[model samples]
Target: MDLTHSAQDEAFRREVRDWLETHLSGDFAGVRGLGGSGREHEAYDERLAWDRHLAAHGWTCIGWPEEYGGRGLNAARQVIFHEEYARADGPGRVNHLGEELLGPTLIAFGTPEQRDRFLPGIRTVEELWCQGYSEPDAGSDLAAVKTRARLEPVSEPGGPRQWVVHGQKVWTSLAHLADWCFAVVRTDPASTRHAGLSYLLIPMHQEGVEVRPIQQLTGTSEFNEVFFDGARTDASMVVGAPGDGWKVAMGTLGYERGVSTIGQQIRFARELDAVVALARHNGTIDDPAVQDRVTRARMGLEVLRLNALRMLTGPASATPGHEVAIGKLLWSTWHRSLGELAMEVAGAASLTAHAPPYELDDFQRLFLFSRADTLYGGSNEIQRNIIAERVLGLPREPKP
Candidate 1:
């Protein structure tokens, strides 16, 4: 893949940089570097307003089609935007689940009416969303989801049918703040595993839904446990046909690991830079071993960016292949190591909380939270299995 930017791409990069530099000032100046993994509880309301500001200026869904109220930017341009956004230390995005994951899935598989109802909200950052794939027993084995939803007719003679849902979803990121959840449910009670599943878009504001924040080592509550007891949505809210949920759910996972990963790498680069600076400040840079590890970290980051760009250049498909699994494995492992390095550089200082309420400095939070990097999203074991069975065409593991 060509690594050099063309004249037009450079111009687009400059435009993105300039806009962010200009607007991320004044009242929004305080929001810089606020909100991210393990730090989503910071200045949430202000960051949310910043997201809406991006929406009002047509920057929220740049990769989406123009007809869907997006700028329809190409892959290169989108990468430039994400890179510039991170370089500017822009606040973490609050609507990413809606804009990146759910929006793309709907555009690819949703009905026309579904698109009309949901696309505008996502594009405008007015309606936030969360994923409902993982359950008590279905973390990485998503097909093991036990959440059940069956169609029930409304009392009115001509009223629409509703899907009454019941189950528990854990590690549901931002569910307490989300307006909707696109869940994979067992629509066919008798069918097992990946079959008989359906993707349903359920509303969040109802009596039967409960969201309890799951506090973390960082003393933040971004992930959540969500319980559904007879929660309901219109039957038409199912994205694809009944028993097609496995397909739709897989598409959403593909999008989750797609082009946006470039942005994450950019952010990781910033974190690494900070760690290096800390090393220099603490006189750890003079240590031969520390210097060697820092060089390796830099090289690993470059490799990650190259792999992500190569994946982006490939033909787009709804079902992600082994490349996505490979990317996940690489980054999660690298990041967890970086967290360990951060603690080493910080020395004894990393052991103390910043204040009384279990407050943590940036490095402390990074060190603590990155420990789970390999676990959440998809575990290292699960990703390895995907690469082996799906990409290498190895014999599938026997199920008990």
Candidate 2:
């Protein structure tokens, strides 16, 4: 929460800045500013190589413990690193679901064997991961998930015991590219709602697993429909005890709203800068309405930054606190509005694609992609419910 950085922190910032400046040239120069939420397919291979290069230099997962192949940095240093990374226009990371979400979950709840087996791959970018929580029927209400998994009966002593999974997960980002999926499946047929759920680490390459990319408004397929028809994984792949997955899944959600979001906010600021520059170029800055909205966006971004810091400094828990929901609501709404503002700045030109291939330009892509910002990662309604029930201690909404 300290706004002022100590000398050591300043030194770390310089280190990150210098490293990014030196390495983000030559072979990796083209990767700078490439790849993000809606544009995950952009420079796919190159961005991946850049991510691995960061790993080689001991830069990825700096917040994790040193024993777990990370720098084990404190919150301040992690913030510094992300800020510098964004300032340098570093490419969007391909392994965020692993390093930011799953790796932390494993370190918090996994067995030593699980950590040993998976952390290395995540750190080295040898294995990419996707979340299998949202379903066709359970997008926002994750507890309504119907995906099922049952144990394959052990044939003999020491014989392999596996879990046979059946069901589908929708809005599974990067599933087409992931090597594994950490899924929430109904482990007990009799259980309902949050009960009987198991968080299983399922392999993506085997038979019975299918990933069909979903085309988005941006004309990209980062999200996918993942069908698990009798997909099997080792019984040991479960993150928590059978039927205790709700807790573990919530833990992952908490991490999903973790410190890594600082980089995202920084990226938002960059987008705002671009929008402001566009308005200036197009003479829209002279309009009173445009000026008022632009000023409001700039103010909202600062408030968003401070809220993030406050959330970070507040109590840390395995499950998310109300702060997480508040943060989600704030950032998502702000980014979505920024997208709207970008379109307003573009005016008539926003309706047209650039050229032969008719690709969407930067503003067009931003406007299209930000439309989902409020809907994904839990919707605005979901966040408001969390704040109401959890923060204000209001009565829970009646279950359907």
The per-model lDDT (C-alpha) reads 0.91, 0.92
Q: What is the lDDT of candidate 1?
A: 0.91
Cα-based lDDT at residue 340, candidate 1:
93
Give a tens-digit lDDT track for model 1, residues 238-258.
Answer: 999999999998888878888
Per-residue error (Å), model 1, residue 390: 0.6
Q: What are the per-residue Cα lDDT tens digits for candidate 2 across 112-137?
A: 99999999999999999999999999
The most accurate candidate by lDDT is 2
- Candidate 2 at 168: error in angstroms? 0.4
What's the residue-level lDDT of 20 in candidate 2?
Answer: 96
